[model samples]
Target: MAFADACNWINGNVNSNLTNRNSIQAICYSDVKSQFGLTANHVVRACARVAANRLTAKRKRRKVREFKPTSFDCDARTFRIIEEGYLVSLSTTEKRIKVPMRVSNYHIGKLQGRPSTSAQVCKHRDGNFYIHIQLKSDAPKLKKSKNVIGVDFGRRDIAVTSTGNSWSGKDISSIRDKYFRTRTSLQKKASQGTRSTRRRAREILKRLSGGEKRYQSWLNHNISSSIIREAIATDSIVAVEDLTGIRERTNQKPRNKTERRRSNSWAFYQLRAFLEYKGIKEGVKVIAIPPSYTSQTCQKCLHIGTRNNKSFKCENCGNNCDADYNGAKMIELWGCSVNQPRGSELLSCDINSRATESLHLPYRKCR
Candidate 1:
C-alpha cells in the first residue's frame, strides 16, 4: 500500500518538475511517512526512486500517463544478509521479515567478498518470489583495437561481417520452422476440437511459447561472442547498421504471411544489444550507422545498384557483389567516415560514393 501511495504521489507531482530527490522529499516525504506509516528511510528512498524514474521517463519523452507503479525498491540500509548467504533481513511497512534465499555459486562469485548496494524484491508471473541484488565492482580495462569490422544482420544469413565471414541461420531457421508447425497444429486442435482438447492445446502452446525465445537468445550469445572474438583478434572495431524501427518498416511493406512472420520474429535488436555489451567488455568499439541504401549502393563505384534476392549488380560500374556483403562494406565505410577527424573532406562523401576507393581492391563479379 505504501508503494502504491508513493507511485500515486509521484504521478501527481510529475508535471511539477519534481525531479530532484531532495526537492521531492521536501514536498512529500513527511506526508508520505505519516500517512502510509512508512519509516523515514523508506520514505526518503521511495521518493528518490520515484523522482528518478519520473525524470528518466520525461527524458525519454514519455508522458505521465505511461508511468507504471514500481513493485518495491529497497536500499542497502533497508536490507541485510543475516545468515552469511542464505537469509536476507528485509524491512517492510509492517515489520522486518527474515526471508530465506537460494543463491547459486555463480551469484556468490559475483559478490566477490563485496557488499551489495541495493535490492529489488518482486514476484514473477510464475508466483515465485525473487530478489535482484545489485553489486558494485571495478570494470576491467579493455584493450583498444585498431581496425574496424562491419556486421550486416539478416533473416537468412543472421550476420555477415566486413571480413567476409558469415554466421548462417540454417539451424535457427529449422528450429523456428519446427515451432511454427507445432503452433499451427496446436491452433487447429484448439479451433476444431472439444473443450478438453482445446485445453490441452492451450497448455502445449503456453509450454512452447518460451522455447523459441530461449533458443534465439542462445544463438545470439554464440554469434555475439564469436564476433567479439574476431574483432579482438584483428584489433578491430565492430560496425553495424542501425535497425531501429525495422519491425514497423517490415510491417508496412508488402510481405506474404510467412515472410511477415519471419521478419517480425527475427531478433535483429537482440543481436545488436548482445554485440554492444560484449563489445564493451572486450574493449571493442561497436558503431551503428544509418542503413539507408546500404544494400543498393555499390562499394566499388559511386552508383546506386539493383538488388535482387542475395545479389547486387551495379550497371554504372559493372560491379557485382553479394547484397549482404555490400551492405556490410557500406556500414564499415560509414563507420570510417564518422570516426575520421572532424571537418575532414571524407565526411562529405555521398552514401553511394566509393568510400573504400583508396584501398584499391580489384572488383570481382558476383557469384
Candidate 2:
C-alpha cells in the first residue's frame, strides 16, 4: 500500500520539465511525506525512480504514462541481505520486516560474496513477490582478435553466421502460426460462447499469453550461447547488423497480413541483446555494422549483386552463393574494416539511402 501510494504520488507529480530527481525531491519531498506518509528514504527512492523512468522514455521518444505500483526501488538504507544470505530485511511503512527467500544453488553462488547495494521489490502476475538484487562487479577485459564472425538475421533463417552455421526459422514460424490460430479461436469463443465456455476460454487465453514470447526468449538464449561459444573457440569478434529502427523502416512498405505479422513478431532485437550481454560476460567483442545492402553485395568482389529469394549472384565476379551466407560474409568484411583505424572512412556508402532496386555503388577501402 505504501509502495503504491508513493508510486502514484511520483507519477502524478512527474512531468517533461520536472524530471530531475533532486529538483523533484526539492519540490515534492514535503508533500510526499505528508500526503503519502512514506518515510524519507521511500520518498527519495520513489522520486529518483520516476526521474530515471522519464529519462529513459525521453531517450526512446516514448510517452510518459502513469506509473503502476507493480514494483518499488530500494537502496542499502532501505534493504539489507541478512541471515547468512538466506534472508532479506526490508523497510516498510509499518515497520522493518525480514523475509526468507527461496534459495537455489545458483542464487547462493551468485550472492555468496557480492555486494548488493540496491534492489527492486516486484510483484509478479503469478501472485508472488520477488526481489531483484543488483550486483556490481568489474567487467573482464575484452578478447582481442583480428578474426571476425558476422551473423545475418532474417525471418527465413533466424541467424546465419559467416562460419556457415545457420538456425532455420521453419519450426519457430510454424509454432507461431499455430499459436496465432489458437489465440484467434480462443478470442472468438471468449466473446461469443456460453457463459461457462466463455469463462474457460478466457482462462485458457490468459494461460496461453506469453507462451510464445517465453519460447522465443529461450531459443534466443540457446542461439546466443552457441554463437558466443563459437566466437570464444576461434578467438573472433562477433559482428551483427545495427538493426535500430528496422521494424519501423520496414513497416512503411506495403505487405500482406501474414508477412506483416511475421515481420513484427521477429525477435531479432532480443537476440542481439542476448548476444551483447553474453559477450560482455564472456569477454567477447560483439559489434554492430551497417545493415544496408549487406544481403545484396557480393563478398567475393565487393559489388552490388542481384539477389533472388535465397540465392545471390554477382554479375561482376560471377560469384553465386546462398543469400544469407553471402550477407554474413559481407558483414564479416565490414566488421574487419570497422576494427581498423580508418574503417569508418572506408565504409563511405550513404547509409540513409533506402533505395533497394537502384544500382548503388559498393564499399571500397581507401588507398
Tens digits of per-residue lDDT, candidate 1, 253-283, equal 8879988888889999999999999988777
CA RMSD of each candidate after superposition: 7.9, 6.6
User: How many steric overlaps are in each model, in order?
Assistant: 0, 0
Clashing pairs in 2: none
Residues 65-123, candidate 2: write the lDDT tens digits. Answer: 67777888899899998747599999888799999999899999888878898999999
Best by TM-score: 2
Judged by lDDT, which candidate is best? 2
Model 2 shows how many backbone clashes? 0
TM-score of each: 0.67, 0.79
RMSD of 1: 7.9
